[model samples]
Target: MNTVTRPRILVVGAGFAGVECVRRLERKLSPDEADVTLVTPFAYQLYLPLLPQVASGVLTPQSIAVSLRRSKKYRTRIIPGGAIGVDLKSKVCVIRTITDQIVNEPYDYIVLAPGSITRTFDIPGLTEHAFGMKTLAEAAYVRDHVISQLDLADASQDPAERASRLQFVVVGGGYAGTETAACLQRLTHAAVKRYPRLDPGLIKWHLIDIAPKLMPELGEKLGSSAQEILRRRGIEISLGVSIAKAGPEEVTFTDGRVIPTRTLIWTAGVVASPLIATLGAETVKGRLVVAPEMNLPGDDGVFALGDSAAVPDLAKGDDSAMCPPTAQHALRQGKHVADNVIATLRGQARKPYVHKDLGLVVDLGGTDAVSKPLGIELRGLPAQAVARGYHWSALRTNVAKTRVMTNWLLNAVAGDDFVRTGFQARKAARLKDFEYTDAYLTPEQVRAHVEGTARQE
Candidate 1:
């Protein structure tokens, strides 16, 4: 009797792209046709766009973390681990589990969507002292740290110490930096009511970036509108400026300004995952260079997308233009890549990824927002509605959508108490303590490991 072998498909990462790809595969492919497996350290898909809200206490971390197993129809095997290395020649991916155990997972076809990491510079004391807004823990820790500063300032009689604790500086002027500065400023503004002794003017928020404009992708008119909104809220906008050095108690800007502050929130930008370096393939700005179809050049059955891949923007008709690293692109690329995978399995021609820009939304907390949905600029409550509506619709599961909506309603009614969760009490909650980017294997190590595993098998 002859038996047929099924193709084994392995997907790395659990971000928007990876989750969307898995969902599409599960919906389209039968068990007999392909065996789908996903590698991730967590079983939930993080709704990252709302992370600023999470940091600001408007939403809980659990509300944004959608469970991967919520869809009963999905039959993909879940390996609770992160891919540390990939050996393309052997068709094996090395994953490090939550328990710190390294295991090798082999596949006939692979999809890489490992996502991006917080890009850092060699500025002094940045990695050690500064806080990040990239992960859930980081967001929670930022909230705790921010509230703690208020608490410390309220109890202290020293004016200098109080000022240092009250002053907050945020780097970068993009969506992340702008939203973070806006939301956290509101948190402090609201929380100050609880501290009657604390002067509201002492609670300062300085939003600085090297770029000349804030949220420049929102276009000139809307970008100026966002800057004005932040400025009106008393957020000090320092355009064309960046941090020269970061200290535990203060930060010095490139323009010769030393601001005394205990908090420095770094939301500068992101780089592709370190896993891309292990592939030993061509890359554009640290992102894997893939064809228009989101497949590796000259390599069959291997795909890359999302923040980790430099996917061509065929819609723009620009040879040098690549898709920007955004959730909107990531989500669409995920579904398209899965379809192409299915097409390849069926021996059909693969389709190239082509999509026009939908628009941009930046929720500035409360009823203040700015959005350009399909080129129509909106502001205030109308823009707020569009921003929240887009996010609510973008949420993957019903449970996530319901929980987020409930949080919004409750926050609007009762308001946040500015309670500190004491996440900073643990040293591991620090920005440098998380992510562990150094845990990945180098290209040479990956080659040796793959050869050794093959010999053992």
Candidate 2:
């Protein structure tokens, strides 16, 4: 009797790249071709760009969190956990489940799409005192924290304490930071009307970046336009500056300015997932280095994309130039890599990933916006429409689309209630609280774990 062997394809992460790749694989591959498995800490694929809106109460958390199980054609075995290590030689992935159980998942092929985590520095009290807006819970927590600050400021008798509570500092000039400052400032601006004792003038928002410009990717004209719009909204723009140190009550800047603030939102940048370290592979600026086809050079059946891989930008025609970690690229790359994976399994040649820039959008809340679609620069209301339309149309499912559309309409007409969910009432959260970057195993440990020689602590 002859037996047939099926290939096991394991995907890491539930991000845009991972979800897209898995969906495509399921659609393209037959049941007998391969068995697909996905390892993720969450069941939903988080639409990360709209996170600032969630933080500002413009959209509920569920609107952007598209459920992975919603697909009726689903065949992938969903693993409710995170891949802590990957032993390339043994072709095994070590996963830590939600219940803290360890499992060794053997795979014929592996696709690494574990997304990046918020990058931090060695500044004093940075991780201990600062809050991040990467995860859904973090965004919700931030909204509650911001409103709590307003409440505390209004109720406080100590003038100094009130001043500190009212003053907010957001660090980073990127999309997340800009949108966060713009949206939350609007939140506080409109929220002060509800608090009778609070003076709106007392609420101050400072947007700072060590870089000279706000959103340098938007080019000079659009960047200047964004900066002007933000400044006009009473947000203090401080370029060429960064936080030297953070404290419970205040933050010291590199320029020697001490700002009395209780809230510090850091969105500086992101480093690739720590899971990449387990492979003991070559990396570029902390990202796993992969070919234009997105496959590991020396390792067959191993692929990586999204924030975790430094994939070469084939459209640029330069080997040294790598694709920037963006949602647009990740979504496209996911589909492209899926085709490559299918072709590889079918014994066909894989093509290189090539894509041109499709422009950018920056929503500044309400009528204020800026976008560059197909190289055409747009600002104000037209840009807002373009930005929102692009986001709405890009949603994965009809349910997600409906939920987002409903949220947008409700927010516009009824506006926000500005209610806190008490996520922060139990305790304050740090960068380490949400992201488990330190939980990944080393290359040696990965081998030991896969071989069942290492003891589980």
Candidate 3:
């Protein structure tokens, strides 16, 4: 007996958009309809918003890592690798696996959700010295590094060295940067009590950004409230400022002020994955240009979403305005794209992806927070409740929700143990370490690869 060949569907990345897309595809598509495969560097979908909490030891890494295998219902083939290049003409994707093995995958339909990398500048020593808060490993390593700094500071006899170790610089005023500075500052603040020789006053955290307003999207009033909250916690908020250079021991500001510090956390911004460029498709500001329906323009089988796609904001009734790269947008887009993909397979008409702005929430650690849920501005405890409540509800699986809730409750009741896993000991990772931005092949290389494979067969 002969079996029918199923349509191969390839999904890239395992972030919010990718994971949601795959899950939805598994649920909606019949067993014989399509063969789903996911290509990602990791096996889990990372809940990125709570990454700051993971770094500050408020939550364990496992709490935020939602395993893709958690579902017993889905049998999606998981490719533990990253797609380096895609030959859209041939419908082939070039992937580099974790073991440094290269392979080609052919698909009838492909979803590009490779997500974004931490955006760095041309400043000298930026990639060599700056720490990023974009990945689970980076977050864990940062926590260890921060704790180690305090330990080293207390042991040092030289006041200069101690001062430098105690001072920390975070370059970004966005939600990630602000929350990181706030959460880590609180960690150091609480940990200083254990060190008799270290003065709590010496622990300084400076949050800076080139933008004039910190999180200007929050509006002036709410942004001001967030700034005030951080300021009251002894965090120095510097607006309209940025790092000119970064060194192993110090960092210089764009305004020419030199600050001695052992730590430089860079959360400035993120750019779409370099994989998008391999397709040689039209892009808007480095993100692949896609229709409001989340399909690549002129390509019915190709879909792009998440941080890597410049999806038009149809909700605003503007063609130029694109959806912001937020978790909420990505999640909704994932579901929408899955429906569209299924629709295409069934030869049905597809609908556009349109979602209204559900507002923003910035958790400034502890009891401090600001939220604008449903256009209603809130601050302090009420805001914190709303923020946590929203995040808790957004978690994909029941296990993930339980772990996050348990971590939060445990941290609140017993406090952090301040233990380092030592996995990152003696291995300092910079901005370029986690983000393999330059790993993608050029369009010519992609064509050559696909053509070579075709000839070999």
Stretches of candidate 3 exceeding 4 Å from the true structure: 1-3
Local distance difference test values of all predictions, in order: 0.93, 0.93, 0.93
Q: How close is candidate 1 to the true structure, as a TM-score?
A: 0.98
lDDT of 3: 0.93
Residues 1-457, model 2: lDDT tens digits: 9989899999999999999999999999999999999999999999999999999999999999999988788889999999999999889899999898988998988999999999999999999999998999999999999999998888899999999999999999999999999999999999999999988889999999999999999999999999999999999999999999999999999999999999999999999999998899999998999988999997669999999999999888886999999999999999988899998999999888999979999999989999999989999999999999999988899998999999999999998778998787667887778887778899999998777743542
Alpha-carbon RMSD, candidate 3:
1.0
For residues 5-79, write the lDDT of model 1, one tens digit per residue.
899999998999999999999889988999999999889999999999999999999999999987778798999
lDDT of 1 at 398: 89
lDDT of 2 at 102: 86
Q: How accurate is candidate 1 locally (lDDT)?
A: 0.93
Deviation from native of the Cα of residue 111 in model 1, angstroms: 0.4
TM-score of 2: 0.98
TM-score-wise, the better of 1 and 3 is 3
Can you tell me which runs of candidate 2 are displaced by over 4 Å?
453-457
